[model samples]
Target: MAGGSFRKSLGYALAGLAYTLRTQPNMRFHFGAALVVVAVALLLGVGVRDLLIILFAIALVVIAEMFNTAVETVVDLYTAKYHPLARVAKDVAAGAVLLAALNSVVVGLLVFYPYLHAFVRFWARSWRGGN
Candidate 1:
């Protein structure tokens, strides 16, 4: 951090992101889901408000994930050996991630249910050989 310029700060942040994506399987999954969400949003032409909510939910999950990664790394740095306090801290961080993931699920449902329902109905009609 000493002598770290603003450009170096950005580089360090990006490096952390790369490390998380490489080391955390869940982070990769979240990124994949994010891509799908963006694709679906574009295809459905969802309203601006709904899209904003979706984006916020996505960011929430990603933020929680990054925080979890940071917490775990710090805990390990504090002690490589097992300790009850370290376990508790890691568990709490993981819980935060789980809660964020669940929240995102609720957001996705609330924002996309109508569009999903319409797609289902369209499929049903097409299945019956009708427009």
Candidate 2:
């Protein structure tokens, strides 16, 4: 009974995560970027370990974006009017998200480049062999 309850709680948590990803524009962007990574990984035939690394990178960007959004929301709620300091704070928070997103892109390219090159080479070899 206790185990079942724990599993239900986990499910709810996962559902909440999904809801956030679906509803939040920034999260949706991150999710779309992640889908692109997954497509690249599939094309490159990424191994399990590489896949884990990619997942970690994606998670990092998503978490950073989420935190940035939360900070912006809190600032807006508290200030409710245009203030130079509030604008600076929001911009800084957004910049952090942008940095995280760029970092994730770099990490994805680094991790997948080798596999992509190898896959291309293998395809070329097989095509030549068949001819």
Misplaced by over 4 Å in model 1 are 1-4, 126-131
Q: Tens digit of lDDT per residue, candidate 2, span 7-122?
A: 99999877767766776887897898799888978877898998998898888888877777677778979988899998988898889888988888888888888987887788
Candidate 2, superposed: residue stretches over 4 Å from native = 1-19, 129-131
Backbone N/Cα/C clashes per model: 0, 0
Q: What value does the lDDT take at residue 36 in candidate 1?
A: 98
Among these predicted structures, which one has the highest lDDT? Answer: 1
TM-score of each: 0.89, 0.77
Screening candidate 1 with a backbone cut-off below 3 angstroms (N, C-alpha, C), the clashing residue pairs are none
Candidate 1 residue lDDT tens string, 36-117: 9989988998889999999999999999999999999999999999999999999999999999999999999999999989
TM-score of 1: 0.89
When summed lDDT is taken over every stretch of 10 residues in candidate 2, the lowest stretch is 14-23
**Candidate 1: residue 127 Cα off by (Å):** 4.1
| Model 2: lDDT of residue 3 | 100
